[model samples]
Target chain A: MTHIIFDLLHILDEAGIDQPVAGNVISERLGISRTAVWKYVNLLREVGYVIDASAKTGYTLRKRTWLLLPYEVKRYLKTKVIGQEMHHFEQVPSTNALARQMMHEVGDEVQPGTVLIAEQQTGGLGRMNRVWMSPEGGIWATIVVMPKLHVDQIFLITMAASISLARAIRHEFELSALIQWPNDVFIGDKKVAGTTLELAADEDIIKYCLVGIGVDVNVSVEKVMPNLSRLVTSLSDELGHDVDRAQLFSVFLKEFERRYQMMLKGESEPLFREWRSLSRTLHRRVRVRTIRESFEGEALDVDERGALIIHKDNGEIERVIAGDCYLI
Target chain B: MTHIIFDLLHILDEAGIDQPVAGNVISERLGISRTAVWKYVNLLREVGYVIDASAKTGYTLRKRTWLLLPYEVKRYLKTKVIGQEMHHFEQVPSTNALARQMMHEVGDEVQPGTVLIAEQQTGGLGRMNRVWMSPEGGIWATIVVMPKLHVDQIFLITMAASISLARAIRHEFELSALIQWPNDVFIGDKKVAGTTLELAADEDIIKYCLVGIGVDVNVSVEKVMPNLSRLVTSLSDELGHDVDRAQLFSVFLKEFERRYQMMLKGESEPLFREWRSLSRTLHRRVRVRTIRESFEGEALDVDERGALIIHKDNGEIERVIAGDCYLI
Candidate 1:
């Protein structure tokens, strides 16, 4: 029903601004009720779409708001559902937190490709209970993914997301972007974006996963953490101009869709290759802190499960499934 | 403060059951006021510990309710907090679902050892979204664990839990119990208990995990799934009599504490040894269904991460991190 209305609106939008087509013409072209066309226009207005209407002067597209409405997103989206049904919030504690709540409320009914977007996050959380700074003008969003992968391969989702972000940033501004191990998008040794993934699953299978992404789109370094300010950089800061958030988001969605499909198909070698190509942690001298002990080594490669294979100074290799990785 | 009260109560309990000790005697022995001793006895009563009190008779230990009250559990608990502060529900969807909700409501303020227990579950969940039969007289509990281990090693916790349950049953009932790979606890090929673990973590560090355990303690197989009537058995059915839930819970707690401590200290080798010794899945041809694909292989061994390492017929070894393992 919604799709039909959207199709009508798209047809009307393509009819050009100066040309006002009659109801008879539209009905003859699309075989829908004239009243139905009028109802859809009113519905679009109720949802913040300014469509000019009249008896003689048919519908005219006025201002296009950058609100992440489902209709607006779907117009540009090419993927299945990731980021298709967006929950836009002006202010939220955290997109991840809201996504988690929504996951429970919706349960299995959660639409695949549902995106939770927040303009600002007051209590944005990072890994290990650390606070993620999500000020205004930043892309603070979480994407729900129902990937058909084993729990071990779950890390590939995050890897794909990181690669997607890196690809999007590179494509938009032609900047030299690199990916940090796990899920941080870096630009010339400084972090520009980060992601935290939370999976809802039992011992045997992953039910769902929420990939929370925070990109420093237009935010300045002073807005982020003081300690991280030196290491983190923003797109606007890098390019000396503000990037279009809507455009970046659409690009990210498209890239994420391609990568996610590959991941779901168990075609991770290509994604892993792309990730490795963009990763700065690999071949870099790094120190990893596990719970029991800490080890310093050179990162050799990442395995299929996304475990870091580190070559120690003693000619031994360690496969680190989980640990805090620090570039020394 | 609660600890001091329980200590005094323990002393009074050990004094005599028939002859009640006078408040003056307790005050003198514990070096506190008679009024304080009276207050402590009232507190114990509030926590479901039935103490018969009289003017001249003083206080006599009659019977203690096996309720998992915070004070009662804290008094006897040896671990940090896993089951010390239990939030119990008579009927809930699932202990794990409740735990996840509580984790969000309380956020990081949730103590590590907090546990959620349900008497009867309306939507008791098992691995792969299977319906877990949690009728009355069954143990439906979720224990919160904040282990400083790698995300991969998190599986060892489940392994340890199964080992703990098997050992508890063996020690308490002198019955031969075994573990089916991944989650199920069995007795002589008949499944008796099962567990589900949910992890909330970042790529590097795991924030917390909820281990939801369901044991057919005193419930008959008839109370469970009709299909499992011939295959499944309960503790009561195995023992030919009803089992005291409180005693069984205590035994499980003690055994869990031992294994949990061992796991925390990086002593998973013994846990794996015990799991191997008590496992029914080993040396069997099994079909593993992961989300991506299905494969058949001989169950070789459970590695350190508690992943079932299967040696396929094609001479390739597959480390299944998460999947439904079915014996063929």
Candidate 2:
């Protein structure tokens, strides 16, 4: 059910686009009594929406705050599926964790492009159970998607997400952000944002992918975890002012869809080329630590299927599917 | 809480083992009243356990039918974690699907070696969401584990499972079972059993693994699906009588742990050599189909990581990680 308040608010937006809308006009359109319409106007006033009422003009929406309301996000999103169905929560343990649980509960009913956004994640996960400091100022959200890809092609989703985030950063602030291979995005050596892509598969077939994004938008540098502030960079700290998270998120969704369509069409060449240009780990001396083994090698190239090819000192080129690549 | 019925039953077995002990002795041993002891004995008799209860003889276990009860499995289980904590259901949709949900519910509280077993799986999953026909008289189970290995080393779990299953078959019935790479256990040209390994992981760490195994124990060929009957075999069909499922499961759990420990110790040679000996896929003309592409190649050898090394027509040696392999 659409909240009556949202329905009334939407009418106010449509009417106040140019001129004031009369009470009788809204009452007729909504099929409610004039007394009920006036009562709703009073409710809107109580909810903090600035409204002007007169005997001649029914109501006028003077100003609206940029909270991450569904209408506010929908007004900006142009994507087909990504972030199409948004579930906003005030607080969650982790968006990705909640996404996984929801997927299990609904099973196939959980549609792709469904998004779960939170203002804060108390137990937000980093890779390998590491603590992710998801304060209220950061954009802590997870986008659920079902990608038609094989096991080897799973990494392509992560690639698309990273490319989308990088493009969004460039589009929004003209910031030259670098994408660290596999997932994290950085501003120079300091980290501004990161992406974690998780999926459920049956052997080679992928069931769903949960792409989690943590972008430090309006976070204060001094408020970050001790000893990590120097390594972490927030948009507000870099821009010398607060950055609108909803605007950045909207831009990201649009960019994400563009690159996602490219991947669906199997046009990986352009995606790979752009990712290579924005990567800081590529063509660098790095230590790749995998679960089974660790080796130091010169990072050569990432293959079509997203396998990082590294030339070892032992005259062997290793194709690493999943591992930690640390620049030495 | 221990079921009062089971508690009373355990006391009867103990008292009957040495001699036809009196009712007062059983009641004393159990710390229950003589009336409660007799009440439990009658309940056990109703449940199909033959107990000779008299004023002189407290209880005597005459026949214990072969059922995969938790206590029976625990009594036979020698391994540490594989089947230590079992979740048994009379009927379920899929053991793996249930296991995944349980893991999500418990989160980090989920311990390794937890097993989910079902007497029947109505919607058991085969790779790629294919319908796994799990009828009565089949072993439908999933073992949960947290493997500390790289993504590429994932196949090692499947390998150990196959090798352990093959060893168990040979040990129990003295029959030969061949392991087809990636996962299926074959007898001659027909498949007798198969395994499905599913996991939740990022680019680096594995959160958990659910290894689903379906063994055709006492299932009649005619009772199986029409198209699959000809290509599938059963233990009863091969052995000329119904085999004990609890023993087979017990043996499989032990063997799986043995092979699992070997892999953890970095002993891949014994595993590889044994897997090669039992593999019908080695050095065979096969067709490999992956998500990205598919092609015909001669199966040359399997590497330490358990990836099938195929020699293509153009002399390209390709490593096949996950795909359906067909004999040409």
Candidate 3:
């Protein structure tokens, strides 16, 4: 029964949204009876798929919910490792928290490219334990990776994720997307997406890494982040249309996989150069606040370890490894 | 009753090992009666304290168990944060495992300098998930630190720990203890201790880090590590006398606290200089084996991020961040 339901969804998905696939055609292709196809199509509709059906024209997929359902994502995902196995939730405490629990429970047995996604999070956290707004209509995901990299090289994982989000948004919508220093993606002068990282490692090897990404896709920025509305925007608000989140996430996985493979091979010069080219913070006057102190400087360059080199006004050149950077 | 018991133990501990204090003396110091003092002394004896008692003289603490009991370690410990709150077990799966679990369960509620220790570990793990030999008479400990450092600077925690062990051993026994890159302590061509690190971090900041140190204190190398007898040694084996583990641990905590403070203040040049001076692997012909490949090189120096710089025989200089190095 499950297989038939999945098969029916696959057929309708291949037919494309708003395009009808005749009932007889789906039955013939899946080697199932027409009655079985009808039953499965009803099941799919019950699970939030909007399908327009008629006796003569068959079924047309009207909409797939914004949720990153595994079947919806895997159908378009092209990466070999990423998204091979996925877990989806309508609401969770946090994808990264659950991912960390899973990593601890099933150490060494967890698949590297497994993905965990949630439509909403009640206890989401940003850097320094700040509460992140994770309402519905946003892409909140954690990708588990077992990279053969040193612990110090872990910032590269965040770099790859941020770059992937930027590239995916740019390629899909032809929008001008830029990367901020460290790991935030911006559209124009406002933030659209951000990335976080968690790692499990010993002295010599990184056992696993969790790269968490939060993109404000179809979120109502004014309603969700009213205090920071001027500093944040959503994709739908920018483009005046809701995006297909599953497709955008699939593009991100592919982009991430390509760069991840390069990093594992010790070929990160190209990635660094790409990050610099797509960077919006470099050579800009920015205020960097670390745990100890805050200072403003011209963002000169990023070193190999992803540390931002800042030339302060006091004629001192400082390397800020981890901090919050704001455009002045 | 618990306070009196604690007071009785404190009196005996202050009187020095095997030095008897009069019953009246303990009773007066604790503001209790002699009968109450005798009862508390009996309670301490039941919990693994070997006490010698006489009606004429008083109670004498003959022995404190080899286990790193909280009272035993805290009595002599004088650190601002490190080991201020300790959890000790007679046997556990692994101190680092329990520490990680506690860190997860408590999150921000956990104290930064909490220490977890075990007399023996049933499933101890070494670097790269190797089986760590955790016999009964070894120092298996994990220190929880919430340093205000970037994720890239985490290796400094391991450096501080390894240096602490080397310094403690040298200061106590006058033996020439040296650190092998990246985090192993050796004495005269044999390994005596090693360190492992685990971290929880986001893209811009580290939430918490667990530094695990395993020292062969009183372990019988031939019995526990028969396959690695020539490569491993214990402190007692080197000193030809059973070392006082609680005293040694207190010294180590002091050593660690000092260096940790220095690292937090960004005064790591002194630490790097100290590590180089006490290093047994630098300036020697070594075999470097990374996950990708292996090659012969001369150990030149370590970079600020703790990466080993090697001059390969092919006239190529390679910076190895995480790998095994063998002196050839």
Candidate 4:
């Protein structure tokens, strides 16, 4: 179903926006019935897409009110495969939910760089079971990667993704970005973006990993959850101008591809070094929450396995492989 | 659908060997069609069952099969929830495949102790992208565990399961079972069983963990894959007798529940101790295989994080959090 939608989008892209093109032309181009093309056009309109139609003319792309469509985002994309196969939804409970479903159905057959993107998520999730507010214009995407790496080394992929987002922010808008341990891409003391890494992994091997990332690209701080409103900021809010989300998404996928290739080749040392250089949590006073207990400490460094090393105030050093780290 | 099967099984159990008199009465009592009852009976017979059915009479159990049916296995069961909700398939690509599907559809509403069992798996999986053989009489079951623990501690659940299997084999058959590091359950230095832990988790929190366990019970060594035939042994082969698989499964689920409760309460130290005690890899010469490289060392101990600590020949110690460990 998503493939058919993409096919229609491709036909529309080829038809161009000069004038309304007939359904027969789209049908012939996509190798589908005219009725099927008309159905898809209606679906696009229902999802906030405005298409101008006339008896003599075909369909004109008047306005694209929907966000994160592959046709719109793929224009600036420059990568081998990432984001090449995208599943876009107007309103989904979560992109990760759909990505997980697709990953199970296809398993390792889901090519690396395949992405699941959604405009708005009703049940958007953050790491540690927290809810992420994914309003319209916010980027909710999960990329499927088959690194064929060990389960522990999988964390390196997450670090690479964080670095990609940080680098993209710096290069595109000249905004200084900081990375919180594990997955968040932050700006100064406030969070501008967050990421969650979910895996369909066994003990020794990872079948596939879903790197679900949510960025406050064009979301207003006021529109975010009230509890998180004070702690979070958006790229649009920080830049004092609304950024083009499609362009931002393209930059992220490209950066992600470069880092992901390095990771697959086991060249994560440079990526980790770059990550450390941009990381703000290390060497800062912080508190770490594990299921067993919570501890206050000064963050030291992240080990090769991506475990956070913390030097506690009580003179004890703790290696935290998994937990929530909050900067004090 | 599974709940209905269990209810019907309970009614059949109560009907006993009194054939016509009890079977007809029970079928009518349950308000189900008599042909539907007979169909369930025929279904059981097709799967290696040896029930005595007469046209003028009803069904009588002449002999119990070694199949892992809920009715047959749950007779001696003792667990709060681990195997309470059962799903049995005659042939599936993988039990993990079915469990992953159920996890999505059921979400958090999935009952704890839910078991997905399959008789034959065409595409059974092992750790690190290996294939697991699931022929008839071998146990292919995945138990859904919802533990309110940090994602890092999730490995402890796997460790505890290995310990439980080891203890169950030792107590039930008086066999000296040894646990290989991470997953494989062994007997006399040969692989007798194996386990794979799949998680729907992020860095800090675990949504659920599906512990897919495959034990070569009551299976002939000649039936196994040629490459693995020599390296593996079954409980039947080890004991030199056809062990009752239903009884063994009941004992394992009972033991698993006890250990799982301890893990959920953050009491993994005792479970870890038991794992070390039962482990054959500890203090033994072994080789650990990771994606980067393979290293030879003497297994020292498993840390609190369930990572294997290996002391190299050069006196350097390596902490392997996730990998394939083989006895050398």
Candidate 5:
């Protein structure tokens, strides 16, 4: 029944938006009774799909839900492998945590490019296990991929994800989206999204990598996370209205899949160049705080491995592989 | 009751091996009745403690069991952190998997340096999820540690673990235990032990690292793994008898804790130097097979991050980060 309903939706989508098809036409096309067609359309309506129905015209699709349901996202998804398999949840402790549990339980059976998404994460995490405010109307997702990359090169996965997010946000909202050092995306000066990558490896070979991303699409950032309000902004806050999350998610997955495939083929130069071009931290004076020490330096460039190369005040060069960067 | 049994065993230990202690003496030390003392001693004997009892001369400690029970191992453990808390099981799927599960369940409550060990793993795994034949006599254990290091530098944890295993095997058996490329330990030409490090990182900072070390102590390698008979070995096969596994495990934890502490304090140079001296793969003609390509080169040296620097036949120096290395 669910398949029939999704198939009905697909047919409606192919008929083009707001185009009405007769009830007899849909029943004949689907090889089902007219009563079944009406029932499936009602089912879609219950899930927030707007279908105009009347005695004169059978049905016309008006709007689809922005709730990030698998069927809704799949309808607009344009990717080869990424997001092909998705587990959508109304709520989870953390999508990354759930993804890790799934990988551990299933081991090799968990396919690459499997996405675990939650409408709300009760305990969402940012870099270094920091608390991330994830409320309803935000995209909290983790993507599991067994990339054909070395352990040292796993940082490129985060870079690619950040680039994908920035590009998607720019494409969707027509806002100038930029990336901060490491893997945080920005709009002008306020943080909009963040990407984190977790890796499991055997020796130097990567067993699996989890790319976790959180984007405040429709969230009221200041109201949800008052402590971090000054530094963060949501898409809805910037645009003065909510955005279609399902569409943004589909675009991000397509961009991510394209860049990820390139990295797998050892063609990472173009992706790295893109990351550099969209980076807001490069060529800026920044304070790099690592676990060991903190220092201020000119952010020169990011190497191929994604390490930040900095020119220090004492005329010495420092390469920081992992740290927190703040624009000075 | 378990605590009473362990306490009684400790009292017998203090009386010295083969030195008999009167029943009244134990009851006085434990503030228990003579019947209670006898019951506790029986409990200890049931769990593999060797105790000699006589009506005339109370009880005497004969020998401690070589089983790696927490009580048995803790009696000799010298480290302050590593192995201070241990979970011992007769059989498990894999110690590493269990450690990961424990961490996921309890999060920060799962302390660093905690050890999970199993007598046998029904579904043991090696590098790249290869089948690891973990019989009753092997030491299959995983130590969970939250190290203060960058994700890229996590290879050093494996290096430290390899060095510790090699040192422990050398100290215990007087064998020429050397480490192969990455983290496999060898005695002569056959593999005697192996170490695998799995890291969970938030971006560049390591959240926790599971250092899984498997040592074939008293196992019969040929009988257990016929295909790998020529490539692997056990301590008993070389020494002509079974080794005290508790002693070996205690030594390894001590060595590991020392190196781990040094790493936490930003003192990895000495540890890296030690790894260099004990490496069997360095300065040898070897074949490095990565996911992308395979090439043969002279293994010149290892960098601070444990990447293999190879001098290729084409007069170019290539750095191999993660791969399967075979000596030519």
Candidate 6:
């Protein structure tokens, strides 16, 4: 139902861009009454969307603001499952948290490709409960997927997400963004975006995977934590202009689905190749700290199942399943 | 509050074992009023507990039915977390399903060591959504735990559960139960019990793990699926008497936590050694089928991370992470 109005709004937008378009023409083409057209305009206005509706002229979109609204996302959303049914929240504690809650409520009824988007998260969560500064302009979203894979291959979901995020940044802004070992996305030594892949599964079956991604889009360094300012960078700060978050988000879902599908189809060479090519942590002196132990080593490569293979200084090769990776 | 009433019920039980005990005598010892004791007795009767009250003899517990009530579990529960908060459902779709739902609702506030038990689950689940035959006398329960471990070490949780279950069966019935690789508990090659470990976690953190265990206690083979009659065994059928469900459950939790704490403290060698010794899959020709592929190999020892090390016929060592092992 929202998608129908979203499509009508786009038609009005195209007509508005040229000149004032007639009400009857839109009504005739859309096969809806003129009163129906006026109803939608009022609905848009109530949601803070400005629609220029005159007696002679049909409804014209005066502006399409950068809101992570469902209608706005549906305009750019082009995927079978990922974001096919989008739930947009203006302000949430964390999109990842909400997605997990929704998954529980709906149970198996929840679709695989559903995406949850939030404009700002008061308590946005990064990996290991780290506070992600999700201000008004940041892209805080979580995409849910049900991958058919073994438990060992679950890490590949994170790997695929990392590759997709890096690719999305490169495609949208033409920036040379690289992946920093497990999940952080960076551009030329400064971090731009990061992803946290959360999964729920039985021993032999994966229930669902929530790919929570937070990208610093239009926020400044000062808007984030003071200490993080030295290490973090946003798309707007690097690009010199506020980027379209809706476009960036939609592009990311497409890239993620592509990589995710390949993984489900039992292809690792491409994902590994892409991840290895974009990863800066590989072949660098690194410190991997886990809950059990921490060690300093030179990261050789990520294995097929996404385990980071590292060669310790004293000559022991270690395979880290998951940990905090620091490039020293 | 429930625990206090549970304590009162135990007192009435002990006094009633020999003869009918007076309510005033019970109240004097417990330091509660006669009215307070009567209120507890009435509450117990409302839940289908039978208590015989004569004006001369006072209150006597006539019968404690085979019900997995909150008070029944709380009476025996002792631990820091695992069974500290118990949710007893008479007929849930699945204990594991309810446990996961509770975890979602309470979020992280749902403490570790919380246990969910059901008298009968209409749709009791095994691993990979298999329908577990949870009859009236069977034990259908799920224990929620928040283990701090690497993703690779996640398998140890299942291993710990297997050992705990085997030990509990041995302690309760003096039966020789063995551990099946991945998760089935068997006695003399006939399966007596099984466990399904469901986990919701991020790459770096575990949200919660629901260890769903189903034990055929008082249930007979005829009550289970007819096809499984030849391969399944129960504690009662072997001992010729109904084993106490609450006793078996409480014992299992204590054993589980002891092994769980050992794993958390990085003492996994003992668990691995125990699992290897009891494993029926080890040193046997087994066909392990994972999501992507399947292979026939000699099942060697399970590695520290709980990967089944299989020596393939053609001379390659295959590590089966999460799979179905069929002895061939």
Q: Give the interface RMSD values of the models in order.
A: 27.9, 27.1, 29.2, 21.7, 27.8, 25.5
Clashing pairs in 3: none
- In model 3, the runs with Cα more than 4 Å from the true position are A1-328, B1-4, B15-43
Model 3 TM-score is 0.48
- Summarize candidate 6's per-residue lDDT along A252-285 as a digit string, tens digits: 8889888888999989888888898899898899
Clashing pairs in 4: A20-A58, A21-A58, A21-A59, A22-A58, A82-A113, B81-B113, B82-B113
Task: Name the 10 consecutive residues with the lowest summed lDDT in model 6 chain B.
Answer: B101-110
Residue-wise lDDT of candidate 1 within B1-328, one digit each (tens)?
2356766777766875565876556767888655455546654654456776655656787766455444444455566545765665556678898677556534454667667777788999898789888888788888888887778788888887888888888988998898998989888868888888899887767888898888898887875567888778899989989876666666677788788889899888888888999988999999998989899989999877778999987889999988888888
For each candidate, report its DockQ versus the true two-chain complex: 0.01, 0.01, 0.01, 0.01, 0.01, 0.01
**In angstroms, how far off is A63's CA in candidate 5?**
49
TM-score of 1: 0.43
Model 3, range B1-328, lDDT digits (tens) per residue? 1345767888888898989998778878988655445545644654567888765666889988656677877778989999987766666689898777666434445677988888889899988988998988889999999986799998788899999999999998899999999999999999999999999887759888999999999888987789998999999889887888888899999999999999999989999999999999999999999999999989999998899999999999999999999999
Question: Local error of candidate 6 at B111, Å?
Answer: 56
Candidate 1 all-Cα RMSD: 33.8
- lDDT string for model 2 (A160-203, tens) is 88888888888898888888777888887778888888889988
lDDT (Cα, tens digit) per residue for candidate 5, span B1-328: 1356778888988898999998778879999766456545644554567787765688899978666787877877999999987777667788888777556534455557889888888898888788888899889999999986799889879988999999999998899999998889999889999988888999899999999989999988878888888999999999989988988999999999999888889888998889989989999999999989999989999987788999997889998888989899
Writing each residue's lDDT as its tens digit, candidate 4 over A1-328 gives 2457667766666676655677667778778655445546655654556776554566788776446777778889998878887766666788888677555433434567788788888999999879888898789999988778899898888898899999889999998998999789989879988889988767788878889888998877876666677788999889887888888889999999999999888898898899899998999999999989999999999999899999999999999988989999
Task: Return the TM-score for each candidate structure.
Answer: 0.43, 0.47, 0.48, 0.48, 0.49, 0.48
Query: Model 1 clash tally?
Result: 5
Evaluated at residue A13, the lDDT of candidate 5 is 88
> A62 in model 2: Cα distance from truth in Å?
46
Give the Å error, residue B85, model 4: 0.6
The Cα local distance difference test for each model comes to: 0.77, 0.78, 0.85, 0.79, 0.85, 0.79
What residue runs in model 6 are displaced by over 4 Å at the alpha carbon?
A1-4, A14-18, A23-39, A46-48, B1-328
